[model samples]
Target: MNKRAIIIGAGVAGPILALQLKKIGFESEIFESRSEGNTREGAFLGFTPNGLNVLKEFIDLDMLQEDCTPGSIKFFNSKGKQIAKLDTAYQKQRYGVETFQLKRANLNKYARIAATNAGIKIWYDKKFVRYHEANEQVTAYFADGTTASADIMIGCDGMFSEVRNQLFKEVSAIQYTKLISTGGYAKIPELSKPLDSIRMTFGKRGFFAYSVSNNGEVWWFNNYFREQQPKPHEIEKTLKTEIQDHLASVHKNDDPLFSKIIKNSHEIIAYPIYDVPKLLHWYKGRVCLIGDAAHGISPHIGQGASLALEDTVVIAELLKSHKDYETAFRIFQSERQARVEKVIKSARKVGNTKTKTNPIAAWFRDRFIGFFIGKQIQQLDWIYGWTYSNKNSH
Candidate 1:
């Protein structure tokens, strides 16, 4: 009998991991807590070269790029003065592929289509509860009262993963970083005619980012530093009027561009930012964790989805030698810990730059951001330049 793996979550990492495993001689079933209807409608995501390369190993990116624009990023201060630009389309000459922008729903949609075409089975609305590992095999329990037996269990369920809660007893839990994020889409072709590039601003009040597409579709988001996490009910209350008025007041002392973006928003969403702390263990017995469940990084660096893709890539490669499953799990953590931890730390540092409230500190930040970070984009080559191959792994 072929080795069967049980995967939790059907989001970004889950479906892609399912495809990767299926290609590598492993049969797997994915269990998602959400029914299909709710998973769609995420705002937009930057799919960098590193993540795109990993996805290319399983499916054609051209099929997905038709809906996206080149992923060039230009940094600026609150005054709208350009600092530096990372022209990802041109950088493809150096990194083999360029970064691109796409709605998260489009990527998820394509991943599901690919997984379905590959004969993978996904059980929707099956929320994971706990797992039992005995006799060297693992069985997973779900909210729907169904069970699955597999040789390996991986948690790809995002940051607030129940799988991590059940398996990783050594760690307390994923912690909220007290940063509230809000984003929306707009149609402002006149103001955002330059669709080839993404514009990011480090403001005195907070951090703001916006991008325009050739067709007048604009994607934008803002990050605010909060001292306390908002309750579930409060989060729901940050809808159109509240978000618009709050954003208007926050930028009252600064540029009006950010206010314009907010005023033009079709819809807005607000949520607390969370991150996974350093883990003493990523796996125990026959079950392990992957993606956001294992190491949820803050979105400051915009590499969350890319890092998840990288995780699934390495896991699939290591799993090729099935008899040494324990060793695969062990080595997977060893290989990934340093990289993911560094990213998490770097994201925090990036967050700090956005939260500067003092006038003197804000002035210093805007004045020297170019001096310090202009060349820093090149330092990220280690991330965008990575490629997966058995020869490279050794």
Candidate 2:
């Protein structure tokens, strides 16, 4: 019998997995809670080489590059001192690809369209309420009273995953980082340098980053923990205060980049950061968890979407080798768990680096890490340099 897969969530991983399955002559369907292609009001998403390569296999890299802007990332200390500048060309040489920044909504729309064109069916407003897994097949029950069955089920439903709840017991749970992210777009008459470079400031108040989007909009964000109790209108009030404080701390009072950007800024949106510590198992029988559903990495690593795409490719490659569902799942979990655990640890460390309240500690941490992070960054070579072949080779 021909094998089929049921994918949860229509986010980055779901559509990509469905597309990869199509490449391997498997049929798959995606179920998403959102009724349309619009995303949940996300800002810019940075696609590292690891993610770009996987996407290039199915889509046109040149086209995506043209659609988005190619940029470099610059790191800074709390006092707006340039710590280091990442070389995009060197990264391309090392990983065979370069990073690009694109709007999260547009990227999702593109993936959704690509999946639809590849003949993958998507059902909206069909939230998976539960699942019944048998030795033969896995059936999903949606809150809309609809039922569907497939040969295999993969959950990419994100941190608060229903699939994880239905299939696997709570081996771990999402932990709040006490940090909040607030971001919005700003219209610029003209940027000094096309705003192609990312500027990040690290401080005791927290970390703030501002970069130009492909559409000539300035995308800026500030991350900080609440000093006191949060009221109902706390996030909104905090956003404005934080922005004002961030600009003042950076001595950007007269800088056109800061003044014009904030002058044209829109309403800010905020959300708390959450992630699972790690999962011992990502699968049970015919159902498996992928992306944030299985191991939700912090945005600190800036690898969440990239990791999700990587999971899709790796799991698909593993499944091709094993004829038995259980064996395939075991292989997938064993291979992914260790790597994900390392990433989770590294991400938390990076996040903590920005939250040190002591000025001396913050300075020491930033400078010490910045001067010696080349080795640490090189450790990521294995991840970004990975690719899949038809022969099931690593």
Stretches > 4 Å off in candidate 2: 66-71, 190-193, 227-263, 365-370, 388-394
Model 1 C-alpha lDDT per residue in residues 106-215, reported as the tens digit of each score: 78878877887889998889989889988878999999888999989999988888988998766837678878777887775467564667787767676677787655
- Using TM-score as the measure, the top candidate is 1
lDDT of each: 0.79, 0.74
Pick by lDDT: which candidate is best? 1
**In candidate 2, what are the lDDT values of residues 115-210, reduced to their tens digit?**
998888999999888888776888999988999999999999988898887765556566777776556677666752446677776643555677
| TM-score for each of the candidates | 0.92, 0.87
Reference-based lDDT, residue 238, model 1: 50
Error of 1 at 208 (Å): 2.3
Off by over 4 Å in 1: 170-172, 192-194, 239-241, 389-394
What is the alpha-carbon RMSD of candidate 2 to the true structure?
3.4
lDDT of 2: 0.74
Candidate 1 has an lDDT of 0.79
